[model samples]
Target: MPQKQIYALPNIVSPANPVIFNPDICNGCNTCVEVCQIDVFIPNPEKGKPPVILHPDECWYGGCCVNHCPLPGAISFNWPVQQRAYWKDKATGKVLRDSQ
Candidate 1:
């Protein structure tokens, strides 16, 4: 008889999620999950709900998930405060990041 061995996944803590899903806008299409190159998301168990961020730290800051989303506001990308780059606009005198 072979003994069954079970292993649990580690709960890794990250500073923040690079990508976030808007529950109000996301239609649970799973498009972002399919488009992610780094496999950062896992399908949500509940129907019509946004997918779970299983591996937020694995995100490569790629906008594929956001760009491929059918709804404009379904997915959004965020840069960690440490990595967020800001520059002063000469014309407007407003500090803004690349995304802005």
Candidate 2:
């Protein structure tokens, strides 16, 4: 038996790219908080939101938040095509995906 590191490369450049936590859909579950290996998210005391990426560069561009998010479109990230940035959810964040 051996311990396997699923996320061996904490800093690996994932195609998932940088993603942001949307305040609207975020239920404050903190699932993303638990998953992130780089301590990317911090609980926002003032807003009572799930958490904030106080240090984004620490983010490995892994869309762990987006993939595990119970709410749709809560986390925004770049996909393979379009070269354009977009949020997976309906609500908008810092980026936008132009309708093609």
Candidate 3:
């Protein structure tokens, strides 16, 4: 009999928390893990994968992870609606909400 091998998937299936990472865009540089002040992210054991969000609730929303990423949009925040602002144009009278 032969034994089957198990493998860890590096792709991010969904947004784990407020800090969302695009797995396709992420180069697995581990920069996000290093820059996180609160230790919210951990390096993925599997190479070439985005870091895991270990402490999602602990994130301070400081934007350090996003600002430091070499590739734009590799890391982005799913800002809570409470924290997001909606503004209306005085002339257009149209309200615009922050992008998701």
Candidate 4:
């Protein structure tokens, strides 16, 4: 019997400001994929999912994903002086602060 080879996935380089995806809210739509200019995500085969963060260090912190998700209270970020940890309109890119 021959043993199957396992491959190692590339690891995220860690961002200066760490951000996380709320799986509860993520529909696995890959909307973030179309928007990201930095190539931060790669498809997850095991999970049958779209782009997962391939390089967190490359994140521009531009809050593009935070603004694009249609699900309310989906994406967010926590940084000093600005805790815009909530979802927003994809068109206007406005965070729903009052709801939070």
RMSD of each: 8.7, 14.1, 6.9, 10.8
Q: Write the per-residue lDDT of candidate 1 for residues 1-100, one digit (tens) a residue.
A: 9988967957556745787678899989988889999888888998789988888877887888899898999888877778878889899899887764
Q: List candidate 3 stretches off by more than 4 Å.
A: 1-16
Question: Which residue window of length 10 is worst by lDDT in model 4?
Answer: 11-20
Give the residue spans of candidate 1 off by over 4 A: 1-12, 91-100
Candidate 3 TM-score, C-alpha based: 0.77
Worst 10 residues of 1 by lDDT: 9-18
Summarize candidate 4's per-residue lDDT along 1-100 as a digit string, tens digits. 8999978966535443334667777666766766777766665554634347767767777777667867655456645335445678899997676332
Best by TM-score: 3
Q: Which tens-of-lDDT digit does each residue in 1-100 have in candidate 2?
A: 8997676556643433356567788877777777877877777675647576666656665777778777887766644454555655546445546544
Q: Give candidate 4 misplaced runs (Cα > 4 Å).
A: 1-12, 46-50, 80-100
Order of quality (lDDT):
3, 1, 2, 4
* Positional deviation of residue 14's Cα in model 3 after best superposition, in angstroms: 15
